[model samples]
Target: MYVPNHLKWRILLAQELKQAYFERENSLRNCKRIFELYGRYLLGTTYDTFLTYLNQRKYRIDNLRMPPYIVAAIGLLEPLRIASERLRLRKMGSPWTLQEIVEEVLTILRERSSTPLDRRIGQAQQHVE
Candidate 1:
């Protein structure tokens, strides 16, 4: 199939962003990783422009159309939660490991999702693993 110039550009951009995200040191400082991982479901890259949009409240968790626990699991990976002074969630854990956290979040999302589509996707993922 012949791809349009605009779509090709978008595909290139997404690939570039994914590459950058995967290459990051897997820490809260690499906020783009969150967006790269969840941008499709979240509607856009929420963490990519978080600093300026923090108070804007542009991205609502409800927009994800996912279970609350999945949302919460993803929220746990947010830089704000990790950096928060009150909860200090990041420090509460033994160590901050982004890969482990991502895996845990995926497991939570897979186990908690109610939709048939999500379940099928999870099943397919499990089969691949």
Candidate 2:
């Protein structure tokens, strides 16, 4: 939940591209407010989380303003995450089962979706079809 040292930075300048979407005056608050990328837990606010979405985007002298969208190698990153979690569990000598792993992996991916799932993964019917 801690902001990494590398991600923390002070605003030397503020440029609001949005049409009055932000209070330009707030950026000129004239204070050395400390901002650690609250969400910048790992790689400058993407690898980990700590702040809620509202707080993450709400700009303040002390808040970190992340990009509107982030392009990630999720296809690779997600599988990597799955593999890493598996590796950690394996190292901890957690009992292993493909079924449990399958369920956990699905849950991890589902967490990414803000909407209900519409696709199937390894349904038996699909294999038969």
Candidate 3:
């Protein structure tokens, strides 16, 4: 029987494809056994490798510093608390103007200067001279 050239080519191609399929199927039979024995280990290795890759990429994208908003809040929050404490302390005391506060501080300093230890120091200086 004389087959056409195109038919012969088609038949050859079909046989080649069928043979490749069987070879691939036979190769996968070994893989099937290997996977059945070491499936959990292989999966764990793959998962760990993928997790490491993701962490590397994440650090590259944003090195593990605090977010900008959190930093801003920390910067603002402490000063606000300090100011609130200062206001509360001011309210708790007698209401004194700036000049009164200066006068009070000067009086306290003067009283300290008149202590016996200061007078003794002054007398020691005169004797040394």
Q: Report every candidate's CA lDDT.
A: 0.46, 0.38, 0.42
TM-score against truth, every candidate: 0.22, 0.24, 0.22
Candidate 1 residue 89 Cα shift, in angstroms, is 31
Q: What lDDT does model 1 reach?
A: 0.46
Question: Of models 2 and 3, which has the larger lDDT?
Answer: 3
lDDT at position 51, candidate 1: 29
Location of the lowest summed lDDT over 10 successive residues in candidate 2: 11-20
Q: In model 2, which residue pairs have backbone atoms overlapping below 3 Å?
A: 37-40, 40-45
Tens-place lDDT per residue, model 2, 1-129, is 645433233121112211112233453231111113112322233221322322344434455453443222323334445655875666587665666666666777666554534544334346445
Sort the predicted structures by lDDT, highest score first: 1, 3, 2
Q: How well does candidate 2 score on lDDT at residue 50?
A: 24
- Give the number of the best model, judged by lDDT: 1
